[model samples]
Target: MHDFSHCQIVLGSSSPQRKLLLESLFPEANVRIVPPDNPDELEFTGSKNLFAIMRQLSQIARTKSENVTSQLLDPTATYVLTADTVIFVPDDFDTYLVLGKPPEEDRDGVVRAWFLDHYLGKTHHAMTAICLRVPGGTVHEAFVKTAVSMEVASEEMVDWYLSTGEPAGKAGGYAIQGLGSIFVSSIQGSLSNVVGLPLRETRELFERVVQNGDS
Candidate 1:
C-alpha cells in the first residue's frame, strides 16, 4: 500500500462511486471531497474518434483540478485528483453515440427511450480519464478503455431498472456496479472502469508520482 500520509489528497469529483472507490483504495490517506464547481463536460462534440473523446475527458479533468486548487491556499503538499468517465457506442460508419446523463426533467420520455434503444444488444466502450496534480505543478494523467457487452434486455427488465431511478445520473443509463450489472454479459477490461475508476491504472499513476517525488 502507498503511504499517503505525507500530504492531503483532494478529490475533485462529486460522484459517490468515485468517492467510495478512492476511499477504499487509500484507506489511510487523508482524502477530502472538494468537488469542482463546473465540470464543462461538453467541450468536444464534433469528433467521433475514441481518442478525441478521451482527450476531451482529460481536458475536463485538468479544468476540474485547476478549479478546485484555485480555492486552496498553500497547496504545495496536496495532490488533487480528478477524473471523468464517458461511454460510447459506434453508431454507423463514421460516428458514435456519446451517452450523456439522462435529462433531469425528462418530461417527454426521450431519455428513457434513448437508454432502451442504444444499450440493448450492444458492445460499447467506457473510457475514463484520471489526472493527478502535484504541488510542483506536474500533472500525471492516463485514460483506460474497457469494452463491455450487454445482453439484449427485455422491455420489462428495462422498465424495472429505469423505474428504480438508478440510471438517471449515470453516463450510459446503466450502472455496472449497481442494479444494471445484471444486463452486462461480459467485459474485456477493468471492471472497475465501468464502475467509474480504474483501480490498477490509478495506483500506477499515484506510484509514478511518488517514485519521482512529485506527490
Candidate 2:
C-alpha cells in the first residue's frame, strides 16, 4: 500500500460519496475538494455501443480532471482524482440504455418508472471511469464494471423509496450505499465501484503512478 500521508490529493468532484471514499483511501493526506467547472456542460454524445460508452465515460473523467487541474496553482506537486459512473441497463433490443442521474424535475414519476420497469428484478452493470492526474502532469485512467442485480420491487415499494429522496442525484435513480441497498440483490464485482470509486483498482492506479514517478 502506498502511504498517502505525505501526499496532496485534489478531488475533482462534488459528490459526497467520492469525497468520503477518497478520504478513506488517504486518511492522513491533505485532500482538497474542488468540483469541476461546468460539470453538467460536458454531455455524453457517444453511441449506444458499450465500448464507445465506456470510452466516453473515461473521457468525461479526464475532462473533469482537466477542469480541476486548470484551477490548481501547482499541478506538478499534487495528485488530482476524478471519476464518472453510469448504470448500463440492458434493453429489450440488442443495445443498452445508459442511465445517468435522473432528471431533477421528475424524480417521482421517472424514477418510480425506472425502478419498476428497468431496474427491478433486472441486472445492470455499474461502470465507473476513474482518472488520476499524478504530479508532473501524467494522467492514468481506468474503468471498473460491476454487475448488479436488483430484486423485484412493487409500485408501493418504489414509491416508498422515492419518498426517501435518495434517488434524486444517484445514477440509475438509486444509491447502493444508502437505503437503496435494500433493492440490490447481488453484485458480481467491486461494491465500491457501484458506490462511486473502486478502491482496489484506484489503489493500483495510484501505485502505478508512484512507481513511474520514481522511475
Candidate 3:
C-alpha cells in the first residue's frame, strides 16, 4: 500500500508515464492514482489559437475532475486531479488534429496519417490543463503551454518512426520523452508539457492546493 502522507493526491489517469512524471517530483507512494470512468475528450476550436484551445481543454478537465471527485468523495478526500494535453501547429494551424494516444485499430478507429505529415518540421504547442478539486466545493485550475520544433522529417523517417510503435499511445504523434525525441530539434517551453504535464506549473499548483488545506 502507498503512503497517504501529507495530502492524498489522486491522479485521474493510469498512464505509467504520467505516474513516473509525478513521482519524479514527489517520489513513488506520495501520490495516489485514480482512473476516471470516462476519458476526457480533447476538442479544437475552429481557430488554431493556442490560448483559446487551452481554455477549452481546461474547462473539460475541470468537468472530468468534478465528475470523478463527486463520485469518490470521502468528505475528507484531499485532492483530485484531471489533466488534458493538446498539440497545435504554429501559424494558427488551421489544420492539425489535436491528438491523444492513438487508439488500437481494434478499438480506436482509423486515425488519419496526414496529421503526422502536416506536423513535421513545424513548430507546435503542447498545452496541459490541470484541475485541482480541493475539499468542500472549491476547484482550482491551471493551463501551461510549451513550444516544440520538429526536426525536418522525411517521409521515410515518419514511416520508420511509426514502425517503432511509440507514437501509438502518446498525445502527440511523437513523444519527446521517448524514442520520438529524435524528431525534435528544439523546444522553447516546458519539456514536460510536451510530454503531457508541466512540472514547474504543476508544482506551483501543488503548493497552492497544499496551502489551501481544504480536505
How far out, in Å, is residue 165 in model 1? 0.8
Task: Give me the displacement of residue 174 in model 3, in angstroms.
Answer: 1.7
Superposed by TM-score, candidate 3 places the C-alpha of residue 49 at a distance from the truth, in angstroms, of 2.7
What lDDT does the true structure give each of the candidates?
0.81, 0.85, 0.70
In model 3, pairs of residues that clash are none
As a whole number from 0 to 100, the lDDT of residue 121 in candidate 2 is: 93
Instruction: Score candidate 2 by lDDT.
Output: 0.85
Cα deviation at 194, candidate 3, in Å, is 1.3
RMSD of 1: 1.9
**Where does candidate 2 clash, by residue pair?**
none
Which scores greater on lDDT, model 2 or model 3? 2
Locate the minimum summed-lDDT window of 10 residues in model 2. Answer: 39-48
Model 1, 1-215: lDDT tens per residue?
A: 66755657889999989988888777645788889877566555775887678778888888888898887776676889988888888878867778767667872265457556776787888899998999887899999999998898778887788788888788877789988898888899999988888989988888888888775
**Which tens-of-lDDT digit does each residue in 1-215 have in candidate 2?**
66667888999999898888888878734999989977564555554778888878988898899999999998988889999998888765767878778898877898887787788898889999999888878788898999999998778888899999988888888899999999989999999999999989988888887776731
RMSD of each: 1.9, 1.6, 4.0
Q: What is the lDDT of residue 142 in candidate 1?
A: 93
Pairs in steric clash, model 1:
none
